[model samples]
Target: MSPQLLSLVTLWAAAALYAIAMVAWSIRLSRVADERIQARQGAGAASSTTAEAAAPAKERVAVGGGDDAAVAAMASGATSFVVDDGDETDLPRRSGADRALGAARAAMYSGLLLHLVGLIARGLDSGHVPWSNMYEYTITGSFVAVAVFGIVQARRDWTFLGAGVTGFATIALGIGLTVLYAESTGLRPALQSFWLVIHVAIAIISTGVFIVAAVATTLQLLQYERTDGERELTGGAIRRLGIRVRNGLARWTQRATWFEAIPSAQKLEAVAFRLNAVGFVLWTFTVMAGAVWAEHAWGRYWGWDPKEVWSFVIWVLYAAYLHARTTQGWLGRRSAWLSIAAFVALIMNFTVVNLFFQGLHTYA
Candidate 1:
């Protein structure tokens, strides 16, 4: 078979592995949730029994004098408790969950290796960089996203993110293969310079990082919403209906119990913030490199092209998100929503602007 065919086959295989990883991660999460729920129920029962046995001692203390002592006794006897959602070390590990998590890690590593192989084959077949067009860009971007996730997972058990990352990579590869597939062709005149390598490659990496950051931010938002009390719906019928639907979905997700295993909203927010910071730095370089490349190729530094405009918009959105988070103390749901919006703009810049809008950057 040709190198191109080999590349395509390997990419498909990688996507299949990613799908398996997603399923395995999901299974692990389900098992963890079940264990947590059972543990909580047992704790609740034990607490109730202890409180019942202590009721007469508490009454004796109350009647015997020392009002402050009575208050302390009552406080100690209170049954309400808060689970330490951020730490899983205290929880009993289940063999099934461990096996599922192990399977997920194995699948992710295998998929990443296959993905690397596919990219190498694509580069060989194209006789140049592998990300010169939409299809190649999607595949390369997804690979970078998964690679970054893997690197982070190595240092920390970020298996909670595995399902999201792998599921996204699989879907993205599917979309690239089906909707954006293109024949291997020589680069356009404008894309022949080394600047193409620097600018587009950085752009792809930054985009991938942004994708992972978006996923983290999204989870943070969900976790924050779950922990925070429900908002009151006050509006017309249609608006109220929408709110009801949203609240219903939130309630359903709350029942999953897996949220207890993942890190708290604060931790997830920190991870997202750090990822976005790195992505923003890379994206800053990408925009600058693009302008430099454009000056060399088109004899101008900044044209009001659709691509340039959208890229600048994305940069501004992320810049605002970071600035607000750091200086204005928009730390929780607010920052998460802003980060999510910025990612949405980035997606639009990649897909809508590339396909529908006409500009100098229309080479794709």
Candidate 2:
């Protein structure tokens, strides 16, 4: 078979593997949620029982002239009436969810490997940079998102993000295969420079990082919005609709316990900020490299091409976001919103600018 066909087959196989991994993570998340619910109920029952037993034990000690050890024994189910001061006990048995999570993680790694193989095949087939069009961009971008998630997972047990990252990759690859698929072809005259490798590769990497940060920020927003549960607010139709929308989102989020497995809103916001910071720095270099390449290719360093203009807008917005997060007291929802808006702009730059806007960077 030809290299392009082989790459296509491998890419689809990778997408399927990603879909399976997503399912495994989803099952693990559901089991974890159930365990949390049961633990909460058990804790409530134990606390109530302890409170009742402590009351009578205190009365008994006061009337019969015994020590506090008797009260502790009464509450602790120790029939020997002895006080155990140490907190150590038998280790708690492991749950099935741990094993399931392990399986899910293994699946993700396998899928990631397959995804890389496909990208390599594509590069071999194309005989140039694989990310020369929307289809290639989506494939490479999705791969980077998964790769970043895997790197983060290596440092921390963020298996909770597995479902989201895999699901996003599956969807992106599906779109690339179905909607954005283009036959392997030669590059345009403007794209023939070596900067194509440096500029577009950095841009794709930054976009992928932004995608991961966007996922974190979105979850953070959903968590923040549901912090206090549903509330009845008095307002006009538009205001009420907004409230309804939030409530609806809260209801949808409740369907999966995976969101509960993530870190707190504060931590998630910090994660998003840090990731966006790295993305912003890389994006800055992408713009700089693009300018240098434009000078080489078009004999001008600064032209207000649609792509250049949007890239600048994205850079400025993220710069403001980082500044607000560091200097001003902007964090949590504010920083998250800023990050989301900037990601939206990045998407628009990729889609709207490439397809609709007339510019020097209209290779797509």
Candidate RMSDs in Å, in order, are 9.4, 6.6
Per-residue accuracy of model 2 over 112-198 as CA lDDT, tens digit each: 888888888898898887999999999999999999988997898666677888999999999999999998888898888899899
Q: Per-candidate TM vs. native?
A: 0.85, 0.86
CA deviation > 4 Å runs, candidate 1: 45-94, 229-232
What's each prediction's clash count? 0, 0
- Global lDDT of each model? 0.87, 0.85
Candidate 2 local Cα displacement, residue 153, angstroms: 0.7
Best by lDDT: 1
